[model samples]
Target chain A: MMAVTGQFMILYVIAHVLGNYTIFAGAINAYAEGLRHWPYTIILWSSRTLLLISVFLHTWYGIILKLENRKAKPETYALTRYRSASLAGRTMVWSGLLIALFLIFHLLHFTFQVIEPGIAATAHPDALGRPDVLTMVVGSFQRAGIAALYVVGVLGLGLHLYHGIESSIQTEGLNNDRTLPVVVRTGMAISVVLFLMYAAIPVSILMGILK
Target chain B: MNLTLYVWRQEDRNDKGRLVQYEARDISRDVSFLEMLDIVNEGLVKKGDDPISFDSDCREGICGMCGQVVNGVAHGPRKKTTVCQLHMRHFKDGDTLYIEPFRARAFPVIKDLIVDRTAMEKIIESGGYISVHTGGVPDGNAVLIAKRDADAAMDAAECIGCGACIAACPNGSAMLFTAAKVSHLAMLPQGRIEAGSRVCVMTEEMLKQGFGNCSNHYECEAVCPKGIKVRFIAKLYREFIKAKGNL
Candidate 1:
């Protein structure tokens, strides 16, 4: 699942980067404006639907692993009076879940606004009456605090991915001399690349490079 | 520091068991948990009292021979370590330690701090082996199992048949023990021929021994000294489902 999600996140980033390149065509804002007219764009609809499914599956398996871990070490982590273990391993669930929460908020802030540009909080019925993905992305990253939060979330994803890939192979009984090393290294590389790429996207936008 | 022991003593399999308190003097902090018990037994022996009988051998951690309900834990205080590996220092000086044999309908207490772990032996005997003939050794290269397959098998083979999984489990299930052994064999081509009967017979033997069903709680994985995971049981379920034609 570490590999699966790491690969998925990388895929999402690549799609984001490639999709962002659409602005290079002509009048990027016009493309954003044209995007609002289509009731159900093919790339928009299918990709969004697949993204939702993958997120669900990722969570579904992540929860299974967590529950299993809890069952095995009921008192080890939770009930131990000594609270000096590494905070990284201790709050693994919350850290991973924070990443999930960030992804949802990200989709809402960037993608939700594009669907129904006019929908207001209570004034609009659809509740998704918003547009301006660029502004939302720029505005969200422009905030120093929000940028820090995103940075932490990406780091959480990295830490979570680090342990998750190795654990998943061991759990799935897919460990081997040849493939285990390959899988671990690839998972590590993908995790690092995705974190850097995602970090750069926000930092670049904040620096007005996406201008 | 010496301690007071409240041990659960049962005369025989048919007899009722109850808590019997005895004071142990001058316990060494460096001694293993069982070594402390040995000191208590020596104290009883000096008075011509019946020494508390517990299961143990190869006092080193590997044999998985020593197990007890020490202070309500299946093993003692340390996580992932076995009873024999636990030392006296973890407890406070002069603390009253409660020692009890692991109890369940599946594991009937035979004496103080000792139960009939033969339930495990029986499960292994039922279907834990491959049907190979004893003769000239076959070349290892003859069987070209993938490196991955061999590694997985080795991991599953690490199960030491310690009943800690049963003791730690809320349901007293031995599914983990049986599954680990089964998985070790089932992963190889030599074992695949008997996989159908092996799972059926061993699972039946586990049930017959009055061991509880695995509900996937995974306490087995946590307390397992060998770290034999709960995933092996999931693998068992998958294989059984496949063999039963349910999948």
Candidate 2:
């Protein structure tokens, strides 16, 4: 259940990052306007619903698995040593919790526009009578603290995906001995590319390159 | 070589275990790890003290009868080596060793360095077999299996059921052992008839045994004495999902 939901969320994140590229193309305001309008609005709302469900299930099962795994090992060794487990593999629960926390803050800051009402896009319309999403996003990223917080959140997502993608592949039995190494490398490559793509937005805006 | 050993000592299942220090003085480096313990046991016997109890049958690596965590690594620091086959030469002179029994909820400590592994037997009994008629002996050439499939089956069949993988896993999952059993059979034509039910039944039994789910840490593969790969686990999932789809 966790793997399925996690992979679904990863798909959503990929689409989200691709959509976010509209800002660089200078069509972010029009794109946001199109999403809020009819027809496209249906896709927007339905995708949001699916993503919300995926997040809830992913976090719920992650916690249950963590608790069950802990219970399975009641007595720990006096000197524990990991042979092949990676640092990211060991701290999955921590990274997952970080992502969950960031999601909440993200929704409040951007989607709901309740966190910073002064820069809320809903209150400021562009010249085309659309929500000034581009300005609002650029304005927010211009702040050093918010940009740093976004960097942290993106890092958490990267670390989570680094382990999560290959884990899901293994869980779903999509890999064999010959393909396992390739799958692992592919997963890492995807994670690094996604991280660079997502983090580049805030970083570019902060450097006054996207404005 | 002389070494200090901090061995876990427990009277019974109810007793809270504690690490008791023992000096293994002037021990020969050529002896197996179990033999070194035997020398310590002999000294305790002479002094009228309760000797440490551990499980071992063949003392050979294939029996899977002996398993203990040496310095926190299951089956010791050597790769793909069981405790019984582990030699004293691996450790340097004057080194301190911490030896503990396999620690998992399913394999509780019955005494010092001996955990009850009946849980694993229960898993095997559930569905780790194939049905064969008791009539005339069948010819070996009756089954003409692909060379690739036969080798893969042999790879998975190498698992010794030592419980070392469970001991090493942070989740204490039995997926590696169960997967090995399932994969070895699923690769054979005879075992394919009951593959669907076998995977489901064994998975159910594993969960019922209080074993945790696999988190893909690959620690089980790392500590496995048989060099069983995690690919067998992936095969187990493949067989399981295919079975579920059919159902």
Candidate 3:
């Protein structure tokens, strides 16, 4: 169930990244406003519902697995050494928690518009009379600290997604010796591409490249 | 090979254990690791000191009896080698070794370096067998298996039921061992009749034994004496998902 929900979230992230690139085309505000229309609104809200359920299920299963793992080893070794386990694999819980916190912060900043003043109240309309989401994103990332925070968040997301995707494929039994290298490469590709794209938004804003 | 050994000593399961240093002087370099311990045990016996107790039947690596975490690596520093098969020649003279039993909640210390590995047996007993009639042996060609599956099953079957997978796993997961047992049976046509129930029961028993879940760290595969691949674990998950639908 955890893997299944994780795959769902991966799909959502891919869709989110593709849609979010509209910012570069100067269509982000129009895209954002268009999502609120009738048919698009239905699709948007349904996906939101699915994502919400996936997050909840993923978290719930993660906690259960963590507790079970803890109970399995009541006593730890006095002196320990890792052979094949990566640092990212070992720090999964920490990365997962960081990602969760970032998600909450992201929703507050964008969906609830609670982080910045006048974000929710003021109507910054574009030439097409659409709510100007591009300006809000640009203004948020223009702040050095916010840009740094976004960079850290993207790094965490990349690490989490890398391990999460590989693990999910393993859990789903989609890998064998012949295909494991491909699976690993695919995971690395997805995480790296997503991280670069997501990090570019804030980086371009902070560098004064995207107005 | 004058080796310094830091051996774990515990009277019983309830007793607290600590590492006791022992000096084995003037040992032959060609002797196996277990033989060196035997020499040390002889000296202790002559002095009326209690000899350390450990589990080992076959001095060969195939039996899966002898194992110890030498220098924090399960089955010693040599890759894919059991403790009994490890020779003192691998170590330099005056080298210090930290010897401890396989540590896990499912594997408790019975005495000195000996741990109770009955948990593994219980998992096997749960569903590691095929239900066949009590009669004459079936013909050799009765069931013709595909070469790929036969080889895959053979790879998984190479697991020697040793608890090294548990000791090596940071999470203490026995997924490799359990998966090997399940996959070995699941791949064969003779065992596929009860594959669903076998996987379900065996996995349940594994969890009940307090073993952790696999996180795909591949630690178990790294320290496995038989070089069992983690791919069996993936097959186990596939079998598990299919089994759950049946259940």
Candidate 4:
């Protein structure tokens, strides 16, 4: 269940990154406005609902898997050693929790306007007379502290996605000798690229490349 | 070669094990790891001290009877080698080794360096076989099998059931072991008749035996003495999903 939900979230995350690119082109306000009007609104709300279901299922299954893993080894090894499990694989729970926290923070900061109130929160209008989401993103990223948090959050996301994608493929029975290495490498490359793209927004703002 | 051994000692299933240090003096580098232990046991016998007890039968890697965590690595540091085949030459002079039974909730320590692996047997008993009539033996060529399928089946059949995968797994999962059994059978025509029901029953038995689910760490493959691959796990999943869908 976690693997299936994780695959769904991967698609959502890629779409989210593409949507965020609207900010770079200074059309974030228009994009936000576009999402709220016409047939797009139904599609938008449906995707949101689907994402919520995936998050809930993914997290609940993750906790259950963790408990099951713990029950298998009631006694701890005095000196444990890892041979093939990677650092990302070992720290999956930590990275997952970090991404969850980031998701909550992200929703509050951008969607609800309950945190990191900025120009967008004040209902400032862009040239197209829509809420200035581009300014809001810029103003938030301008601060070194907020930008650093974004960097950390994306890195955690990268770590989570790296293992999650590979594991999901295997769990879904797509892993074979011929395709296993390719799946692993492709998952890792996509994770790194996604992290870099998300990190670019905050980094570009902090570097004064964007206003 | 002289070496120091910190062997885990437990009187019974309920007894708490502790590391007891023993001096292994005048050990030969040419001897297998089990033979090194034999030298130490001889001294203990002559002194009327309780000899350290460990499991061994074939004194070869083929028998899954001998296994212990040597310096935190299952079946010692060498890849694809069991403790029975692990020679003393792999260790340096004056080296210290930490030897302990395979640790898992399902595999309890029966005595010093010996764990109860019958939990694995219980899982196998659950559904690891096919029912056949007590008739004359069928010809070997009766059931024609493709070369690819036979090769894949043999690859998974290499699992030695050493429980090293469980000891090495962070989750202590028996997925690799169970998967090997399931996949090796599922690929063949004879075993394919009951593959669906067999996988379901065996997997349920594994979970009931207190084994954890595989989290795709691939640690089992790295530590397996028989060099079993983790891809069998994927095949197990396919078999399971197919079975459930049919149900």
User: Who wins the lDDT comparison?
Assistant: 2
TM-scores vs. true structure, each candidate: 0.57, 0.96, 0.95, 0.97
Residue-wise C-alpha lDDT for candidate 4, range A1-211, written one tens digit per residue: 9888899889989999999898788777778888989888998898899999999999888989989999998876656788988889878888999999998988888898767654554467777677878778888889899899889999999999888789999998889888888998899999999999999999999999988
State each candidate's chain A TM-score.
0.64, 0.96, 0.94, 0.95
- Per-residue lDDT, model 1, residue A188, is 66
- Which scores better on TM-score, 2 or 3? 2
- TM-score of predicted chain B versus true chain B for each candidate: 0.92, 0.98, 0.96, 0.97
DockQ of the candidate models in sequence: 0.03, 0.85, 0.73, 0.79
- lDDT by residue for model 1 over B1-247, one digit each (tens)? 8788888888888887778999878888898898988888898898999999998998777888889877766776678778998898887788987787775567777887788888899999999998766357778798789998898889889877779888766557788898888888889988977887788899889878777655433556767778786667757765665677732
- Candidate 3 chain A least-lDDT 10 residues: A117-126
lDDT of each: 0.69, 0.92, 0.88, 0.90
What are the per-residue Cα lDDT tens digits for candidate 2 across B144-199? Answer: 89999999999999999999999999999999999999999999987988999999
Model 3 chain A TM-score equals 0.94
lDDT of 1: 0.69
lDDT of 4 by residue, B1-247 (tens): 9999998999999998899999999999999999999999999999998999999889879979899999888999999999999999999999989988888899999899899999899989999987845257778878789999999999998888889999998898999999999999899877998999999999999999999989998989999999898889999999999999999
Off by over 4 Å in 3: A119-122
Q: What is the Cα-based lDDT of residue B245 in candidate 3? A: 84
Steric clashes per prediction: 4, 0, 0, 0
